[model samples]
Target chain A: MPEITILTEQELRQCAAVDAGAVEIVSDAFSRLARGGVQMPPVMRLDVAEHNGEVDVKTAYVPGFDGFAIKVSPGFFDNPKLGLASVNGLMILHDSRTGVVRAVMLDNGYLTDVRTAAAGAVAARHLAPERVGTAAVLGAGVQARLQLKALTLVRPVERAVIWARDGEKARACAGELADELGIPVEAAADARTAVEQAQAVITTTPAGSPILHWDWLQPGTHVTCMGSDADSKNEVAPAVLANADGLVVDSRSQCAAMGELHHAIAQGALPADIQPAELGQVINGELPGRQAADEVTVADLTGTGVQDTAIAVRAERRATELGLGTRVQA
Target chain B: MPEITILTEQELRQCAAVDAGAVEIVSDAFSRLARGGVQMPPVMRLDVAEHNGEVDVKTAYVPGFDGFAIKVSPGFFDNPKLGLASVNGLMILHDSRTGVVRAVMLDNGYLTDVRTAAAGAVAARHLAPERVGTAAVLGAGVQARLQLKALTLVRPVERAVIWARDGEKARACAGELADELGIPVEAAADARTAVEQAQAVITTTPAGSPILHWDWLQPGTHVTCMGSDADSKNEVAPAVLANADGLVVDSRSQCAAMGELHHAIAQGALPADIQPAELGQVINGELPGRQAADEVTVADLTGTGVQDTAIAVRAERRATELGLGTRVQA
Candidate 1:
């Protein structure tokens, strides 16, 4: 029988968080992905329309890693109505050599959130100005707060702005984040106001149409759009992609299909034959990220399977160091 | 917190097995698949060529079922040399409505074997001769034994024959199966001899070249090929498919990619545009299975995600009834 470790959500929280180590881990995964020999298949998604729910399964095998991860993420949009979290899932880490499962991280989507936020930090680290005076985020959801926190780890974000359609929610989130991060976080009066002053901007909303306009961006500002994961969801105007000095995506094929790049191409704002650099390529120094100090850059993150593998491997290693999970014989 | 039932291999063995009930469950699942509305995605696969191993992930969401299943199956063919089983993995069952996991079945490939054998029985029940006097299998592996045992549940298989490249292993398997199933069994000298005397023949070997020829099949014989799961593996000659009176498949798209139909199409023995009827259609009376007693019907079982969901649901329900699993909070 193979011995398997089971890590609960609380245990996972202790081992992994939006910290410097996570950003480095995700950054290294992107660098490895760009170097090649990574087997990351297209994600598998199952939609249960009747219940307004969907489940996505992702996995990747990186050459140097001792183990690979398969993450199962379920999002039932209606769950929040029943006072339950909208997203819940677990990651199964398997030995790369023998294909035997090593651990099960029942983190209930914490690791996914952390990896997503860490990807934002990766983009900021490579594209944002070295000293960011202000960082702003659009949306007042869980990810909106985490993305800003993640940015603080990469850039010197002294102050932050929060903007959302729900003004009251935005104000409440700004106040909570202010106390949590020990930084000045104020609710912006409008989206334009938020983008005007920040050197770094992040969009984390499930908008079906564009919310940020092309004219709102300033030079030397780095914008990371983690929303627009589906074909129907768009947060940044298509014109913003056309006007940006540098455009990077987590996965070019995926971004062209479901990311903000998808919307840009569909709207003909970007040339049909245009080739955008991948974040991995930029991380590995194979492609240019921000060539000049006054150049505006944009990164479209459509979550990759490689990120899940990277984060799960880190969590399992940390848990092993701390002896945080229960061992079960299978 | 959701209460998750953890069922081990021993517990799963008590709940699910190769029997009449399992056949009925698998048959019903196939019928439902034919009826449509089941959300079964393409199987996800990861290959670790360095270790000579591969892993496949399959899932399905069947309507009207409270829970659906996701199965992770790993095949490390080299493990046998190290005194370990080549195949090992588990199934996870989730609540369909809420998208929350309900049970974890750590069956270590036992459930998969049962489900596969049950699928074989389902094919035999609908396609094989009504009263089979002699049944023959082409391999001396675990599935060869289970497939014959499964056949006995649906057809009156009085005696059986076993043939393999290793004659000693074949003879030993023949004796063991005869004693276990309470029937007369013999080891055939060659593939031709094994098919010549049996009313029903099953090909269960992982042969790269065809082992069962078209000329060896008789008019009343029904053949089920379950070994050619990958495109590189073949058990039945291409002529067998072109010459069969009734041809059926588990999933047309899957069969075209990696099953016997794939080889037949590649060999140009079968038409490229041919639309063979699915086995589900045969069971549901939507298509003809065996119109006459002398018709040579062949079923290409490529294995499907719906089968995993069906079998896991059955195992979980039975385990719940018997109180045969450990409950954990998630």
Candidate 2:
């Protein structure tokens, strides 16, 4: 009988610590995605309006990978008020040869957190300036903290500035980052204060309306916005995309549906001369990023199935090395 | 922490005997589906070409039900030759309000088979004439045998005729059914011979091209074609759909994608005067079925998500009542 391994959330937490290896794995995934041999289907979404919840299923297969993952992510928007998490999920990995169940990673969004943060670091490694400066983060949520932690691995970021609608949450986030990264982090008075003096600014808000404006961007600043993953979400204004010298998105088709680019195109604010390029292309060096030292760049990240597949494959390997999880003849 | 009950294949096999209750449950699911309150997403398909296999994820939510089910079915076409079953899967039952896993049914496609046969019975119950002499099943597979058994519950079927690509397999299937159902069964020389004298006919072959033709069907026959769930599979000729006196489909949207209706539409074989009604509409009395005793009625079932959810719910309840699963904290 074939054994199906069950990797519980606690076990996943024991093995998956976001590190440079995760960044490299996801970076290679992006390169493969740009190489054009992967098959990732469009996400399947089920919206439960009565419970203010939505579940998204994503899957992908890289031709050379030993296995692939189908991740189920559910967002219960009203859960936070009820003292529960808003997002939770698991990933199912299957054998590529026999299409049999290999492992079930019950991460409850932990792997997604790691992969998304790793993507942020990849974006920074390719697009952010090499010199030392403070990075600005516009949110005090889980993503805001993870992005800053990931960014510190690639760039010489000495400090960070945080901005959020809730000022107290922003202050608490700043303190947590300062202690964790051993860098001076401060809470910004507003979004403009956060953006005006940073080398790389990351927007991580789940705002319904634009939270950051274009006029506040500094020259040569690279902005990575990772929060606007749905149609109703917006972090930066449409003008911000038009104003950037180069605009890159994780997936063009996904952005056209629920990304900031879709909002910008709807508002007629995107520039005609600047054609958007995929981040994978930029990472693979097929497309140019930061052509000039003083040119502003923006990358929108809505997540991709390739990253999930990559991370799941990596997690399964790590679990084996650590001798974690229960194996059952399922 | 919540406990997740695991119903293994052996356990499911011990409890999942096809009965009239499954028919009623699925019949009600179709009614709920047609009543327009269920939340079911489009199917998510992942292809594993290396294994000559594909996996489908299906789910549905009926409004007043306490829980719903998401089923993952994988078809490894080459496995049977490798000494393993070609089809296997499990269903996950989750609390609708909390979005938490309540049970995991390791059915190995047993629940799907039972539910599918139950759906066929439900279809025959509503569409078939009050009495049937002999029902012809056009396949010599697991579904072919189960469908005949299920049909006996709703109709007075005393004999069966089966035709398959391999005449030897057809004869074996006939022998098995005769021993199990206490009915006279025979292997037909051809598809025409199978349908010519039958009162009710079922097409259950996963044929790539048309195997059954419109001209072979007899008057007063009710045909339930349940194999063409994918675009590449077509069991009955398009002309068969055109020749039916009345046509009812599980879902019009699904039929337009992968059912016999799609092929019929592609070939321009559909009639201009008849608008296809949903099976739920016919079951709920919102539409008519088999208008005359001598009419040729066709029901195209592309297997809806509601049926999966309903069957899973029923399986979970029956398992609990019988104390048939191991509940482990996952």
Candidate 3:
């Protein structure tokens, strides 16, 4: 067995801003996935109760690689009650040559956060308008914060508005993020006010009901929906999706099942012929991302196994080089 | 993320025989699996090269449980060359409630090997006829040795015959195992000679070609084949399967694809309606295991994810209670 080094949540947070090493891995995974060189097993879900759902397990096997990542993310019930975050996991790296497990990284949804955020950046870089300067963010959760951080990396945002049900949480989140990114971030009174003036809007709430209104979106606005990972969860209104010029998703199959697109299609708001291109195709320049600067574009940001594998691989290497955590040999 | 405990290979080996707690876990896993309460995903395989095959990533989710185990067993080419055992892996146990990763167990295939061996024992206890004494083992590798050890735990074996292509290696394995178990063991020069006098036989080589001949088996002899796990791997002759009065397997789909039954069906020797009983059913008493003392029975053993999850859960608890490894929290 190979020597394995683990990275804690603190280590992962410390390395979050400097994850250039992980970007390459994420890019490679995306390329391999787009080329059909990777075998991702269907994402299995187990319903804990009628109201709560958890991703039972998600896994992928890349042909040339020895190991794969199995991800399990439980529901978000405890987050609000315990003052703790939901969605934690570990990525195990196995040796492809000897079937030996090489490393285990405590992703804690950190890598997931990074890769998903990077993917958001990737989407903004390709799908958002060239002159994207104003942005609106819905929700004050970790995903909402990361999405903003990642969007700023690709697009030059001059001002940003944040809106959440909890006024204090949104204000604090806006203030902290604004200070960190050196951008003007103000808390908006409602979703309509937050998204109406922005060129790019991101909905990151875990609300099952539609939060973003169709009338709030401007003519050239690009909307990135990051919540709604389950069948019952919806972040954007069906009318908003129908008004978009083009829809892009991380994976068409995923978006058509449990994502926001699924709800849109169910409501007959999105046509059956709406075949969204995968994020990889846009990143690889295989498909056109955003056709016109003022075109209304939307990218359904359902996560993928490729992202988990990519970031886990990178984090494992970094943890090893830095002697970040305890080493366990198996 | 939850606190994670790391267990190394050396630590596992040190606790192997002494850890009855881990054995109970293996037992419970089989029981739970037998009860139809566990969901084990299909095992995927990736052939990196012509001679190297890796057991690709596998994940399992049990409903009502917060975490799942992701297993990655890489290719096994370098182990023999490096004078080390091949097939090492780790299991990451995450919190089913929060998806926070809880522990990383460096199984080093120790838990896998043990659970597999325990499954063999379970099969023998249910499939084999009572009053069995002599046993024949084909191949003197690690699995062959474990099979004998586990079989003896459930059956009162008086003597054993071990056979391998290399006589010296077989002799060494037989001598060492016999000394450990206090049973008479002899190294057989040929495959047929090994099974000629034994009432039970186990084939554990990775030979693609047939090793066990049908004519060498007695009428009532029980055969357990555990070597064939990939599309290109087979151990027993198809004629042996044809001659068996009853056939059983861990999973029918898996057996039809990669087990000994796969070879038989490929050669048109066994009909598609062969309808092997699932090991789970037999264990749960839903299907009869062994009927007649003079009936030839064969059990095709392909490893399962339930075993990995069961063993990992058990090992984690035991290791924690014993304070056996280093724990890191995030």
The residue-by-residue lDDT of candidate 1 on B153-240, one tens digit each, is 9888889999999999999999999999999999999989999988999999999999999998888899999988888998989999
Question: Residue by residue across B104-156, what tens digits does model 2's lDDT show?
Answer: 77777888888888889988988898778888999999899989998998998
Worst 10 residues of 2 chain A by lDDT: A270-279
**lDDT tens digits, residue span A1-330, model 1:** 788887888899998999999998999899988898888888889988889999999998888888889999889999988887788888899888777878878888989999999999999989998878888899999899899999988777899999999999999999999999998999999999999998899999999999999888888998999987788899999988999999999998889989999999999999777789999999988998888899899999999988898999999999999988878777
On DockQ, who's better, 2 or 3?
2
Chain A vs. true chain A, TM-score per candidate?
0.98, 0.97, 0.91
lDDT of each: 0.90, 0.85, 0.75
What share of the reference contacts is kept in model 1? 0.63
How far residue A174's Cα lies from its native spot in candidate 3, in Å, is 2.5
TM-score of 2: 0.96
Which regions of candidate 2 are displaced past 4 Å?
A271-275, B80-83, B271-274, B326-330
By summed lDDT, the worst window of 10 consecutive residues in model 1 chain B runs over B1-10
Candidate with better TM-score, 1 vs 3: 1
* Number of the top DockQ candidate: 1
